[model samples]
Each structure stands twice: as C-alpha cells, then as structure tokens.
Target chain A: MTAINPVEILLVEDNPQDVELTLRAFKKANLTNYIHVARDGAEALEFIFCEGPHAGRKIQNGPKVILLDLKLPKVDGLEVLQRIKRDPRTQMIPVVVLTSSKEQRDVVESYKLGTNSYIVKPVKFEQFIEAVQQLGLYWTLLNNPPTGGG
Target chain B: MGIDFTNNVTAGGHQVADQLAASFKEISDLRAALDEHAIVAITDPQGRITYVNDKFCAISKYSRTELLGQDHRIINSGHHPKEFIRDLWTTIARGKVWKGVIKNRAKDGTFYWVDTTIVPFLNDQGKPRQYIAIRADITARKMAEEALRQSEARLQTIVESLDEGLVVADLRGQLLHFNHAALEMHGYSSLAECRRHFQELPDTFELHAMDGTVWPVGQWPLARILRGEKLHDLEVRIRRINEAGWERVFSYGGMLVNDATGMPMMAIVTISDITERVRAAAEIRHLNTALEQRVIERTAQLEMANKELEAFSYSVSHDLRSPLRAVDGFSQAVLEDYGDQLPEEGRRYLQSIRAGAQRMGALIDDLLAFSRLSRQALERQVVNADALVRAALEELAPLQQGRRIEWRIDKLPACQCDPMLLRQVWVNLLSNALKYTRKRDPAVIEIGCQTNSGSRVFWVRDNGTGFDMQYAPKLFGVFQRLHRAEDYEGTGVGLAIVQRVIHRHGGRVWTEAQVDRGATFYFTLEEGITL
Candidate 1:
C-alpha cells in the first residue's frame, strides 16, 4: 500500500468533561494521528475556512472529518456545518453530528443536512467512549473518500 | 018645597069643582122641581132616544133638538167592549136598573166619561116601555183609578222574578210578604206556608249569632228591626230542610224598607249557597303544592351530572402518564445496551421498537395535556408578541444551533392572552419549523406577524422539505407523521400539543406548504378571545 498522509480529525465541543472523554476514547481506540479541537462553533468555522484567527493556516490541508456539537456559543454547530458544506473547498469533507440531545428532531435534522452520521453522547461515560470508538474506526479506516490534494 | 032643594044641590056641586082645580096647580109645581134636580133622558128599550131634559142635554154637549130624536149610539165613544154594551141592554130590557161608568162622544167628537144608571119604565103587565137613564160626568176620578192599577201590577212582577230570596216580616216576626224566590229558597211551597209568625214557621231554624251560638227567631232580623236597629248585610247560616238531608245555606239580612218616618216596619233577608265554590278552591291549592315538589327533584339531578363530568377529566390527565414513561424508558435501554451485539437487521428492528415506544410516550403526553387544558382556568395577561418569540427561540436554541438558518423576525403587536399557554404555542410552532427546514443548504426561517382586524397573528416560515397539502389535517393529530421514520424522525405530537395550547387560549393554528418547496406555520395567541 502506498503511504498515505496522517488523518486529521476536528472535534467541536463546548463541555470540558465531554472533550476529555472524547480524547480518552480516541486514545483507547489506538488510532491517533493528528487531532485538533475547537471549543465553539466559531472556532470550528475559522479552522475550516482559514479565516479570522486561523488565516495563517494552510487552507489546502483541512481535517478529513468534522465532529460537531449542536449546542455551542458565539456561533452554533448547525451554522458551522452549513458553512463547511456550502464552500466548495470543504464540501467533500465527512461530517458527523455529536450531540447530548436524544431528541428525534435533532437526529432527523442532522442527517437531513447531509451529515454522514449522527450519534448521541450518552450520559454514562463508558457508553459514550464506546460509541466514539466505533464511529472513529468505521469512518477513518473502512470508508473510502475522494482525496483532493491541496 | 021642591024648587028650594034643587038650588042648594046646584051650589054644592060648583063648590066641589073649585076645590079640585086648586089641588091640580100644587101638584104641577112639584113635578117641575124634580125635573131640575136630576139628569134624565128617556129612550126606547131598543136604545133609541125619545126625550131628554135640559140638564141631560147640557151634560151631553147637545141641544134638545139633537138629543130628542137620536139613539144613545150617537154619543157612544167605542171605549167600552161590545159585551159591556150588550149587558147594559140586557139589564134594562129585564126592567132592572144597571149602573156603570160609560164613555160617550160629544157632538164635536170630544170624549166624556160618566157614572150612569139606566131604569126601565114598565107597563101594567111588567113589559119594558121606555128606559130612563141618569148620568154624572166622572172623567177626573176614572184617571186616578187607572194609574193606581198599573203601579200595583209592576210591583207584583218584580216580587216574583227577583233572584235574591227576599222576605219581609213585621216587627213581631209575622211574615208580611214572601217572594216566589224566597219561598223556593226556604223550601216552602207558598207565601201562606211562611205567613205565620217566623217563630211559628215549621221549617224555620235558629240562626247563629256573632259568637257562633244559636239565636232564636225572636232575636233575629225582625227582632233587631223591632228594637229600632238598622241592620245591613248581616251574614248568617240558615238551615234548610231537603229530601237528602238538612243543607246549610248562607244568608244576608237587613232591615226592611219603611215610611220616611223611620219606624221599624219589617225586616228583609236574602240567601245564597257557597259550599261547592269553597271546596274547589281547596283542591286547587293541593295540586299546586305537588307541582312544586317535582320541580325541585329535577334540578337536583342536573347538578349531580355536572359534578361527575368534572371528576372524569381530572383522572384522564393525572392517571395515564405513568405507564407511558415505562414503555419508553425500557425501549431506550434495550437499544443502548444490546445494539452492537445485534446484527445490522436486528439493530434496525430494535431501533424501530425504540421509536414506536417513544412515539407512544409522546402521544400519552399529548393526551394528558389536552385533558389538562379542559380543566385549566383562564389566566389573562398582556403578551408582547416580539418578546414572547425571542424567549421561545432561546429555548429552541439547542436544536437550531448547528443548522445554517436565517431568521427574519418582523415587528409584532401586543396581544391579550394567557402567557404560559401562549408560550407553549410559540415553542411548538418554531421547533417544527426548525426541524422541517433542516434539509436546505442555508435554512431560511421567517418569523413575523400580521394584524387582522383586532387580532394579531404570528407566523414562522421555513424553506425546507414540505409535505403534500392533502396530509395537512393529520399534521396536528397524535402519532400522525407524514414522512417515514427512515426519512424523518418525529414523535409527531409536537404540532398537536401546539394546536391544543393555541386553542386553549382561544387562538387558531394552520399551515401552508407545497411539496419539497417550503412550509409556513401561522398561529394566533388570542384564539376565540376578543379584545
């Protein structure tokens, strides 16, 4: 197999405890490459579009997948998802909606906006880690995505 | 001696002749005086006038020349009946004198009334030869007698036809007159039966006094009048003898009419029967009492039915939620714990199971809300629509945060409505707009209001995948979802709850949509409520 560039994952989450759990889950899965974090919807949008504070970053080397939280401050997760999907540069990137809300409307709406998958962050810490591990393994290793070199 | 005797006889005969002549003159003067003192006329027995004296001619208004040859028929006024004239002729022809008041006509056709006597002059064999009639003008005395007869007849007719039983008794209680009605009322056959003193009347009974004690006839109406008392309308009960039994009669008594001097001459009493009228009045009172009792009973029954309905609604709201929670919680547990262990097909089936339970839970919640709305009392307050929309959008922020949506809020008017119920209406409608608009690249949500007369209607519009208009009715029904579970996830009770909340505030909710274009939901906070 030809050598591939290391996979980059972007996690947009507001809660500190949830972020810690997500990092622990990635470590447990043994699939760490390059992992980036954005505390709010605004930070995630800047990182994807390379605008505002993230203007110095190279735009061509964006994250392969975005994990978005529906509830966030400054800018909301749905707006970040819409900005990423609307721009041609970030349109092909896979999006996974990660939320604490189990509301049916949230799940249906996430998928309807072209989210690759939707997962509710469980209240129990162990179940949440397990769900993250499975999602990471499936999307990073098994799924084939179009690679457009920047 | 023969010559001397012859001369003496001749002298005596002459002297006797002279004495006879003096006696004849004295008799002729007496006959003339008799003719002036009496009105006399002589007619044949066939009533033909033969001779009339000067006095008879003067009273008849005729001269002797007219009266001497005319029959009595010439002065007949025709006032007397044929039988009256015939009787006069019969009595005179039998040589008896007949006396009567007769009417005759004068020569100038004026009338005269006369008291007349006709005497037949008879021959030696007692056969009538002529009639001698004596008359006196009596017109003034006859008029007085005729008027007296008419007044007496009128009084007699009134006494017989009176409706009241009238009794007139003397001061000693001796009955003077009893009318026909009075005799009938007292059960007596005639006035003669009551003619005895009231005390002696066989059928008379004692009247009750004011103290309710019996009073004898001597102390009754006649007795009061005799004691110089003027009694009027004294009510008394009289006992009457009837074939069935003795009947009690109500009577009124008063002093009888007397001369202007005010002497106690007689007492009068009148009576009537009132037994049937009194009994009928008592029966009507009894029926009225029974009708009042039935009306009270029916009113109590209606009150009881209203109370029972109130209790039933209370149970519907509080008792149905417990089981619904259990179904949803257990299904969620099964999916979370065993989802990975199950195959893909098995996982999908479990997911469907979880969805169904969740849907059922939502339905139960909606049902409880509907029941609660019926029991909730209205709480009215002023609601600023713009502020209310901001609050509801804040609550729904978690759902729309990650979506690309454009919110265009317009100026809205203040409304009079229940604040809490109005909030529920905004939550349901705005959340539905957010959910359905998720498919769009940049979801556009428009929040605005319009004024219709006195009411303000608020709306939330979305550019999303809308449904067929045919299924619009089912949008607010419990568990009635338009999209399949795989395409869209929903419990479908959100819209239904919204509709119920708006309706409770007397408002209305409606949607307009075209397939795959967009959906707009319009609602008012002041439903049937008027300003």
Candidate 2:
C-alpha cells in the first residue's frame, strides 16, 4: 500500500476468514478501488492517522471509508470509531459498522458514535456478499465526501 | 335554798334588815348579768314552768306573758327519747346538776340545738325545791361537723371504686392507702399483705426499666412521686417476689399531691397493664426484619441469574454466528469454485450444508429473542389493535403473493400494551396461520376481537393444516413442532415467542385445533381500552 495509489477502503476486522470473505465480496462486486486490510482496530487507527509503520502514508491521501467490526483484538471497534471521529484529520472519513452481532445495543451505540451505517453480517454467504457489495458501491462510487481541506 | 327573812325579822330586826338589803342588791346585779347571757326557765318541782326570762322567751319564740305557768313540755323538740328525758329528770330530782345537748323546738316549729344544764335547789330534806334550766345555742357547730363527715365518706367511695391501681403514700413514701386494684397489682389481696413501705418494694418486687435494668427503690413510682417528680408513661416490667416465672409489663404515672398551704401532702400513683401492647409491637418488628432479609436474599439470587443469561446471550450472538457464517460461506465457495469438477450429488450436499448452517443461525436468533424477552423492559402504550393487525398482515404480504387469500379482519379494540412486543405476537401468530395454510387453494385468515368483561380476547383463525388436540399443550414450547420439516418448514419457535410476549403483557394465550382442520389462536391482553 503506497501513498501514490491512495487507499480507498479500510476494513478493520480481526477474524481471518471474515477478512478474506469480505475482500472476495468486494472483488466480486467489482469495486476496483484499492482496499487496505487492518487485522485489528489498533492497526486500522495507525493506517488512518499515518502512525508507526504507516508514518510514511500521508493522512490526506485518504481511505474514503472505514469498515469497522465491534469485537476485535487489542483495541475494540467502538474505541477505534471514537478516536477517528474525534480527530479533525480523519473525522470526515465515513465509518460503517460491520459485525456478526444483531444485538440492539451495538446498533444503537454505533449510530450514537457517528457511524455512517450499521449492517449485521448474515450467516448465509449470498446475503453477506450482497450487504458488503451494496455498501461498497454506495460509499466508494455513490456517496459523495466533502470537498476541499479541513 | 330560800332565805327565811320574814320569820327572822323579830329576833335581829336592825341587823337583819341591813344584811338583807345588801344581799338583795348583790343578787339583783348577778341576775341581770345571767339574764343577758343565758336562756333561763324556772320549773316547779312538778315540772311546771314558774318563771320565764326574756332570753328564754326569745329562744322558745314565745312571749313571756303567754308562758308564765306553762309546763316545760312546751319547748320539748321530741328529738330525745323518753328515757333520755327521764334520766335528766332523775338527776335533777336528786338535787344534782344535769348537763346534756338538747334539741328544743320553738313555738314556730323550727328546731334549735342547745347545750343545757339543769340545777335542783334543795329544801331542808335535801329534795328538789325548784329546777332552773340554763341553755346555750350550739346549732352552727353541729351542722359544720355533719358536713365534714359526709364529704369524707364520698371521697373514700371514689378512691376505692377505681379500675386502675391507685396508691397514696406519705411524703416519706410510707404506704398509707391502697385501692383494690393496687393491691391486686402487687399480687396482694389486702393492704396488710402488700409491702408497707417504699424501702420494702425492692425486696417484694423486682421492677425493671424498659431497657431491662432493675430499678432500685428510689426509682419506684411512689419514691419518684415523693421526690416531687411528675411521671408520664414510665413503663416497666415487674416480677413479684415469691411468684417465680411470673412477669407483667406495666405503665405508671404519678404526681405529688399538695395540701392547701402548698406543702407536699402525699404521693399518688396510677398503674396500667400494657403487656399485650408491648408484645404485639415486638412481634411486628421481628416480622418486618425477617421480611426485609428475605427480600434482599431473593434479589441477589435473581441478579446472579440475570448476569449468567446476559453472558450466554452475548456469546451466542457473537461466537455462535461466526462459525455458522464460515460453514455457509465455505460451502458456497466450494460449490461455486469447484462446480465443473464436482458431481451433482456434491453440489446438492454443499447446498444442504449451507441450508443447515442458515437454519441453525435462525434457531439461535429465535432462541436469543425468546430469552431476551425476559430482559426487555416493557413499554406500555394505548395501541390501536386494528392498526397492529393490519401492519402484521402487510409484513406477511410476501407469503400471500402467489396464493389466493381472503382476509376477514374484524373491528379491533384499542389496548394498553407494549406495542412493539405485541406486534411481535401478532406477527408470529399470523405467520403461523399463513405457513400452516400453505396447502389451501384459498387460505381464509380471519382476525377479530371478542370483549368479555373488561378484557378483549383477540383471535387469528385460519383454514389450514391443523394438528391433534393432544399436541396442543406443546404448541407454545420452543422448537416443539408437531408436523415434520418436509411437510411444513418451521423452527417451531413462533408460538413460543407469542406466548412469551402475551405473558409479559399480563395476558393469556391458547389455541383450538383439530387434525386437518383450521386452527384458531385466541389471546387476551390484561388491560384493553374500550373503543
């Protein structure tokens, strides 16, 4: 991942299988924009804010959207969401919560913390594929981000 | 004795005349003084009145001119018996003086008490010559004495008749009086048997303070009152000496009684038995404490159970679904990627695997929902039943797409319930109706309400494949299905969810069905607002 070809989608998920399935779904949906995978919430934050190993990546070279999972290793998804939304440098990046939990509290908390969307990961492969693809097309190609510098 | 002046005049005429004149002057002065101070009547030896003085006339209410020769019976009041008058006469006839208090009547019939003295003047033979009766008025003193005796009798009666124990003691706390109740309180039948002094009280009875400390003699009711201390409900426990294992609770109140001159006259105390009241209050306090302890213990247990349920639900929601997702996703991956290499049976097997994973996921979700029913706070509202049924029907419209279905939705009453949960109930029951009646050429689903008393019973009747009545008991159990999965596809949790929702709203749910006949599910919400 280089700053020359700016990251467009950041998927913050800990489960390796879920990560592969999500990436496959994005490829099937024909979302050609570069997708960066951060295995946990901490790596996701580092990539978004250009810290640690990702210090060379310019913060302005944006990942247009962040796909967040609530249950993750090290730093959980909600904390990662709070940090991203609170900082002026990455606050404008759209965050969508993607998780296997249909728990009411999780949905309510995600929206309350400035999440752009919430979707429960369906058990059936087809439904999960449809959900990921629709969100990908909407955030990458359909939904517009704010123009100009903060 | 009468002076013999006229016979002795020849013997010593000059000397006798001089002495007689001197004696006459002295006697005249003494008679005037006696006339002013006393009521005098001279009675003859035969009991006839010979001379009456002005003082006597005034006391008898008779004129001197009317009673010069009248007998002494004219002023007799008849208050004295005949023997009493005879005794007085006998004393006077023997030349002695008789003194007594006589009640004499006046001419006007009003009585007067007199202190009278009768003197007999002796002749030469020492017999009665005349009787001179002298009297003094004593009416006022006698009346005052009578009034005092009557008042004392009344006070004694009042003190003795009291129900509460009354004790009167001298300032030194020496017992002077005890009413019957006071004696009974001390376990004594008479004052003679009770402790006679305050110092003896501690020996005869053990008196305890409310806090169970023994009170000494100085703290006793009599001693307290004697010290000029006013007592109110001074409660104590008393156990009489010699009466083992017998105790009574009493309330004592007292005051220092003062004489007219403001000096302490005596100490007065009142005692009342309050054993029953004290025992009842103690029992109530004990019960309250026990009840509070039980409630605290129960609440702790319930909280622990709830925490376990929450942890289980969270694990089910997160960990359980991920594996199912992997199973379904990998199965789909196999079928799609290895399609040309795999035989027909392999593809079908992969499809079954995916179907099985998805079905398991659905079951986990429904089970979580049923368990979550216990945790969800019920939010009650006035809901339009007609709107709830319509919404449920509309949500189930996808099932109605390929079929000919007639909906006979009757007018529904408004109700008080948690709208969201109640909607879940309607969805589950109506969906069951739709699913079970899938084989019908024209599925007829009827939704209506029948109000009984204050509660309205709502029912969903459908012409569908019904089951035997014997299995009706298991209809509301989780995953308790009567029909096979090949015949009617279901996880059999719809009615369980329905029953949970209805029960949470304080309502009842039941069903009526027969094999191959239509089933009607009836439910009554506890509070139904009449519309």
Candidate 3:
C-alpha cells in the first residue's frame, strides 16, 4: 500500500465484496493506475480534506476521478459528493456514481449534484466487469478534469 | 167615570147623621193606613207640593217643613222626559188617574224607585181642584231587574268573543247559541245558512274516527256529547272539498253541560288541526329508517374491500415466494456445483440469475408492505418522536457506522399515533436521507419539529445531494425515483410508504430542496403536541 504516492482514482465504497470485484475488474482491464480505496464516507472525506488519517495528503493533487456509490456505511455517497463538489479544492475532480441500484432518484440526484457520469452495476459479474472496464478506460485514460487553485 | 160625590154623600146622610159619621171615620182610617205604608203627597194644580205625609218625608230624606209647598220637581230624579211628565200632568188635570213607576231623587242625591198614582179632585165644572199623588217604594225590585240585565250583557260578550269555536246546542243537537268562531269554523256563508244546517242536523262532513273507522252522525263528536259521553283529544280526520277531498287531521274534544237534574243540556266541542304534526312525525321516522340502511350498506362495502386486500396479501406472500426461492436456490446450486468446471463468464451469469431472483423477492416484499399498510388497522398510542428517530438510526447503524453524520436531533414532542407504524416512517425517511447523502463526508441530518406557517412541522434535513424542487411531486410515489440504481440501493418504496403512514395519521408530507445544496422533508401529525 503506497500511501505516499499520488492516488489516481478514489473508489468510495462500503461493501467489501463490491470493492474486491471492482478492483479485480481494474486489474484485468490492464489499467495499472494507482487506485486508492476508502471503505466508507468518513475515510473518503478525511482523505479529501487532508484531515485525520489523511492529514499529509494535499487537496490540489487530483485523484483524477472518484467512483462513488450511493449506499455506504457512516456517511453516504451523496454526502461525500456534496463535500467534494461544493469545495473549490476538490470541485473539479470528476465524480462518477457507481452503484447497484437502478433507482431513478439516485441517477438524477447524482447528475444534479454535479456527478460527471452515472453507471448501474450489472447483476452479472461479467457485465459488471465490462462496465467498470469501460469506466476506467474512459475516465482514467481519456477524460481530462479542469484544474483549479485550491 | 166621574164620581157624584154630593149625591152619594146625601144618600148616605139623609138616613142619619150617624151614616155620614161612619163614612168619615172609615175614610180617615184609610188615609191613616195609606200614610203608614205609602210615600204619599198632595200637589196643587200648579204642581207644587201642597202636603206630604210622614212616609213621604222619610222616603225623600227630608223634613215635613222642607216638603211643604215644595214642587214635585224637588224630589224628581230627572229620569222622566218632559213629555212624560207633561202627559202625567195632563191626565191629572182631566181628573183622571195616572199611574207609573218613577225614579225620585232624595235629598242625599241617591235615587229611589216608586210606583206612583195621581188622582185629581174635580169641582162642579169638572176642572182639577186638588191632586193627590200616592207612591209605593219599588227600589228593591228595580235593582234586581238592573242586575239581571247587566249579567245577561256580560254573558253575551263572553260567549261571542271566545277564540275556540263555541257551539251550544240542545240535547236534540239543535243549535241554541253559536259564536262567530263557530260560524267561521263551519264555513257557513251566513246565519241563515248555519241555521238551516243546524236545525236540520244534516250529515255535514265526511269524518274518520281516531281508530280509522268511518264515523256516522250517530258517532259524531256533538252527538256523543249529547248522549252524555265526555271526550278528550279524540283525533279525527275530516275531508275538505277545497283540498281536493284529501282528509286533514284534527284533534277533537268534547264536554257536555248538565242541568241540575244531571241531564245533558248542551254539548261543547273543540277542534284543532293536526295535519302538519302528523306529517312531520312520519317524515322523521322515514329518514331514520333510510339512515340506518345507508349505514348497513357502507359497512358491507368496507368489509368486501378488506377481504380482497387480505386475499391479495396472502397470495403475494406464499405464491410469489415459492417461485423466487426456487430461482435463487437453483442458481446458487448451479454456481456451487459447476464452480471449477464452468468458465468465469458462466459463473458470473449464474450469479446474475441469483441476484435477479433476490431482487424479485425484495420487490414482492415491498409490494406486500405497501398493500398491507392500507389494510392494517391502526393501533394508536402516545408516541415519542425523538425516541423513534434514535431507534431508526440504531436500526441503520450498519449504514451509519464509521460515518461522521452530524445528527442535529432536537427535543421532539410526544404525539398520539401508532408507535410501530410511525417508527417505520422514521426508518424510511432516515434511510432515504442516508442514501441520497452518501457523497457528503460529514452528513448533517437534522431531525426535529418546527412551527412553520402555523403548523407543527416535523422534518428531516440533510446536507446531501438534494433534488430538483420540480421532481418533488414524484418523490413519494411507488417506484418513482430521481437517481440511478448504480448510485443508490432501493426499491423506491421507502418514500411511498412514508407518505402512506403520514396520510393514515391524518397528516401531510412535503419536501423543499435545491439541487446539490440539501433537502428538507417536512411533515405534520394530525393535531399533536406543539413544538
């Protein structure tokens, strides 16, 4: 766990199984980027704000994109989003809502809250992997985030 | 005829001076007797009181000195007209006898009645010489006559002015007296018209007795009273030709007046219209019967609706679960048995099948819950809203664990509501807030009560991804969502159930939000403790 290296993508998810599946998808897609995982909303917040355990982390260094889930232990995905999007330091970071719910409010609320993209996790593991791979390919290698002073 | 006084006196005297003496004695005796009993006075030809006896002086309340030479006018009560007095004077002037009852005034200004007779003495020329006036006291008889006349006048006024149609008839039903009210009540055109019917005793009206029996004249109210029967409030119906022959109800009562011998002399009857009273009683009875029927029908309809919901809920629980369980179990079995042999994609496909079945199972549960909420009878009790909120947070502790959620919970008031049902409301609202605010690091969910615009508003405010105020209308509908499934995990029944619970408690639910700012959902309980 290279904690000091700049994190390329922040995966804010609570389910350990989902985290494992997403990580495997990233690995199999051959996208060898430094991925930082925050198990819940609180950890994600501390990392973003450079507070608590993530005190040494800087706000300007980008995670490139955040793959967010709506359901999380402690603080939820939407709360995590509001903090990042409302702040000048982390507002420009691309946020993609990745969740298993097909609920329409989840998608609409994510986009309305400045989510860059929204994707529902497919029930089949193969489809889920394919979706995650496409997300990684597009956001990590293709999309560019607007840089700003924080 | 003129009396020959000298001839008669000579015929008696020629026989003897004793005969004249005897006649003089007898006349003197008669004069004394008249003086004792009669108020006698002798008036001159000019109507002056020449002499008055002691009886006249006593009856006139005057002394003999005052009566002597006084005119007869002195004791006149002024009751007689000038012509009447003149006639009496003329008769006396002709030496004729005049007799009449006269009212004379005493010296004390009180009146006395007298039966008076005047006789004039005639000279050789048949002219009046002296007049003798004799009177007998008649005051007691005159007073009795006046009293009888006054009593008769008073009786007539009372009989004519009475409001109730008073009809006094003989035992034979012949009318003796009928008041004006009776004439009008009978609808008679004139006294002649009423007299003909009363005298003839015609069959006047078609009438029904209280027992709904046709009444003949023999059983009529007046006839019964004549036969010595006393009746009170004997309800009867009378047919009126002016009313198109429809019968009208009347309260009839009768009493018979009896003579000293206990024989019924006259019959008195009273009639009052009771048509409106009878109709009103009937209307009230009919309306009450209709109201009872309506209540029975509505109760049956509610029972039928409840039975249908019960059947639907039962099938959803049993029949639906069997298929869902089979799908999930079989998929799980395939994944377990073919784990090493099957390709990775095939294994993943089986997992999808299992997940799909599980999702179906969850859908069924949500559907049943929504339906059951309507059928469920509410057991209302005093509920503490703050305690329920705390319990809901505890229930979602797995989601709340490790989360820095700033729950600004305030002191909540107690309200009357179903505790179990309201707790579910709290869970759904809190979880919805938690789900939508997942992206925020330090989620601030404020749960408390407020008085906004004259309402005791209970609200859950969250510093999370709020929705467009436009889409708020769809927030509480089943399966209505504004976010994608990948972002949040829900069947979209949470808010719908919350709305249902609030509505069942006779309250309303609404939200205020700005996209990406925050959301505040407010609700009001049906007349609860104020914040």
TM-score each candidate: 0.39, 0.67, 0.49
Please give the ranking of all candidate structures by TM-score, highest first, separated by commas.
2, 3, 1
**Predicted complexes: DockQ each:** 0.01, 0.43, 0.02
RMSD of each: 23.6, 9.8, 21.5
**TM-score result, candidate 2:** 0.67
Q: What is the lDDT of residue B464 in candidate 3?
A: 89
The positional error of residue A144 in candidate 3, measured at the CA in angstroms, is 68
| Per-residue lDDT of candidate 3, residues B168-261 (tens digit) | 7776777666677666656655666555334344346677875688877677777788777887887787775443456777777778887899
Worst 10 residues of 3 chain B by lDDT: B1-10
Question: Where in model 3 is the C-alpha error above 4 Å?
Answer: A1-150, B1-245, B251-277, B280-284, B452-454, B528-531
Q: Runs in model 2 with CA error above 4 Å?
A: A1-4, A123-150, B1-287, B527-531
Stretch of 10 with least lDDT, candidate 1 chain B: B1-10
lDDT of 2 by residue, B1-531 (tens): 222335444536878878877877887788779888888888889988888788888888999877877887888888899999999988998889999999888999998888899998887999988888888878777667668888887888887888788888888878888888878777888777653777876766889998899888878877778777899899999988777757999999999888999988888889988888899999999998999998999999988889888888987898999988888877877887787789999889999999999899989988888888889999988889888888888898898898989889898878888889888899999999999899998999999988778778899999999889998999999999999999988888889999988888878999999888999999987764434
Clashing pairs in 1: A77-B402, A78-B401, A78-B402, A78-B403, A79-B402, B506-B527, B506-B528, B507-B527
Ranking by lDDT: 2, 3, 1
What tier of docking accuracy does candidate 1 attain? incorrect
lDDT of 3 at B422: 91
Interface RMSD of each: 11.3, 1.3, 9.8
